[model samples]
Target: MIEVKHLHKTFRIPAPHLSRWERIKAAVTGDGAEKTAVRDISFTVGPGEFVGYIGPNGAGKSTTIKMLTGILHPTSGEVRIDGMSPHKDRRRVVSRLGVVFGQRSQLWWDLPVRDSFDILCAMYRIDRQRQQRTLAELDGLLGLGEFADTPVRKLSLGQRMRADLAAALLHEPDILFLDEPTIGLDVIAKRNIRGLLSKVNRELGKTVLLTTHDMDDIEQLCDRVMVINHGSLAYDGTIGELRERIGLPTILRVSFEAAVSLDNATEPELGFTVAEANGCELTVHFNRQELPALEVLRRLERYGTAQDVHMEEPDFEEIIHKVY
Candidate 1:
């Protein structure tokens, strides 16, 4: 489990060079040119929970992760992993945690994948029998056997990623911090990694905090989502709740028994605006808050015999844009 309370991180950026008059002007105006990467954000994650931390570039997602993992100390506020401060109790806390950054590799570049696992075993002081069992489980779940003997430098992107994931769990850490673990991966590769993450959370009971730009990764893997913008928490809730909060227009495509005129397709009673219309079909967009879906269907029935009706909700990416 993880807990963060009123966390804040600020960086003092160098001010741009200015002329004598400009410098004097800036000094008089009281401009310090400071950047706040995280602004008093607070959240908690329980054991066996998978939470997605997402935001745009420079939105403080990585900064917050670094503070949580003890890589960077916060300017103020508190962070505790299982009631132990990460900075104060780093060794113990890290022993119970795993981290995988997609852009970086923890494996020794000159060594074989198997050798990296063995080194981790010794580093963590994992018993030989338990290490082997963990490796076997990882091989089964992540398919690391195919290239287990290959050097870290020789494996492809997907292979290297899977090997890194296996390495992170060799000691069976309690929490996993994943920063864009699926970046630059293809569709099939992404699916494999996501399936492995889901198994780790559900079957192994590991708490995971994932940060990524890919919406599909969040949709497929996370039960709860937290959004950050301008160094502040913008939204924190279930994906369904996020969708409702954004209030994206719902789209409905209706087919009729007879050709309907596009000119007469506007229906204020149903609270739907015509998006498109063809020979025997009309595509309309409406706010679900304005009219109930069932009522929209009832009104469509009056237009014609109603051959068919199909509705589509907004995609996760669209909802994220709405957040900003």
Candidate 2:
């Protein structure tokens, strides 16, 4: 479990120097300028919960994660992981946590994949039997056997991601933090990662906190989601709740068997906004809050027997856009 309250983090950045005079002026100005990356943000993740933390670029999502993982210190407020302070007891806290940054690798680039695992075993001081069991389980779940002897630098993006994921779990951490775990991965590779994460959460009972820009990742993997915008908590709840908050409308596209025009008639009382219509094809937007989808269908029958109907909800990108 993780709890963060009124957490704040700020970074002092040097101002750009326009001339030698400006450089000298900044040295005396003391740090030039400061940017508050995260400001008074607060949230909690329950044990065994899979939560997605999402935001646009520069939204402070990474800053918050770094603070939680003890990679960066917070300026103020409290962060507790399973009742332990990560800042004060970083080693003990990290032992109970797993972290994977998509843009960074934990594996040794020049070493064989298996050797990297071995080094991790030594670092964590895991016993031989436990290490073997963990590696075997990871190999089965992540399919790392195919390139176990290959050097990390020689592996593909997908393979490297799987290897990184395996390395993160070698210690059997209670909580996992994944930052863009599926970035730059092909469809199959992304599927593999998602399947592995689902298994880890369901069978292994690991609590997970995932930060990603991909809506598919969040839709497929997260049960609960937290949206951050402008360095603040914009939304937090179930995925369905988020959809409703954004007023995301479901689209129903209908192609009629024959062309017909009811343009002069009173608009059908479907509790939906008409998005588009062309002779036989009509697109309607129905707010789930105002009407259940099935009811919308019954109302559409009055126009004509629909040749086909396609229903779609908003994707993660659209939802984030609405939040921002």
Candidate 3:
């Protein structure tokens, strides 16, 4: 479990100098520009909850994660993990948390995958039996055996990601913080990582905080999501609640057997907004609360033989767009 309260983080950069004399003038003036990365954001993650922390670039997502993981201290406010302050007891807190940054690798580049794991186990003071068990479980879940003997530098991006995930979990931490874990991965690799995250959260009972640009990752893995923009919390709720709040209509594209003129036919009492219409096909936007999808389908059956019907759900990007 994690709790953050009124968190604010700001960085101060030296003001630009106009000339050699101006540099001295600025230094004497003590003038600097302060950039606020995270501004008074607050949230909580209950045990075993899988949360998606999402935002556009420079949205303070990574900054928040770093603060939670004790990599960077917060400027103000408090961050507590399982009732313990990460900054106060960083070493102890780290033992109970797993973190993976997609842009950085914690593994030794020249070392084989197994060697890195071995070193990590030694660093964590893990017993051989426990390390073996963890490695075996990760190997089974992530299919890491294929590249266990290969050096980290030689492994493909997907393979390295899997290995990094395994390394992060070797100690079986209670919470996992994944910062763009599936970045640069192909479709299959992304799916594999998503499945693994779901398993870890649901089956393994690990609390997961994931930040990604991929909406599929949020849809597939997160039970709850928090959207941030301009260094603030814009939206925080269940995925369903978020979709409903946006009034973002679900798109239903349907193709009828024959063209039906709207002027002559009596309008069916369907609780859906007609987004667009052309010839035999009509794009309908409906509120999930007002009309269940099954009922909509049944009503559409009355029009004509439905050739094709495709439904599109509002994605995370769309939701953020509405929030910002």
In terms of lDDT, the best-performing candidate is 1
Against the hidden reference, what TM-scores do the models get?
0.92, 0.93, 0.90
Winner on TM-score between 1 and 2 is: 2
Off by over 4 Å in 3: 18-31, 264-271, 291-309
For model 3, residues 163-230, the per-residue Cα lDDT tens digits are 99999999999999999999999999898888888988888899999999888899889999999898
Q: For each of the candidates, give the backbone clash count.
A: 1, 0, 0
After superposition, the stretches of candidate 1 with alpha carbons farther than 4 Å from their true spots are 16-32, 262-264
Please, what are the lDDT tens digits per residue for candidate 1 over residues 211-298? 9999999999999999999999999999988988888889999899998865445545557787887888988788887788788887
Colliding pairs, model 1 = 96-174
Clashing pairs in 2: none
Give candidate 2's error at residue 103 in angstroms. Answer: 1.0
Quote the lDDT for 312 in model 1.
Answer: 92
lDDT of 1 at 304: 78
RMSD in angstroms, all models? 4.0, 2.2, 2.9
Candidate 2: segments with Cα more than 4 A from true spot = 18-30, 264-270
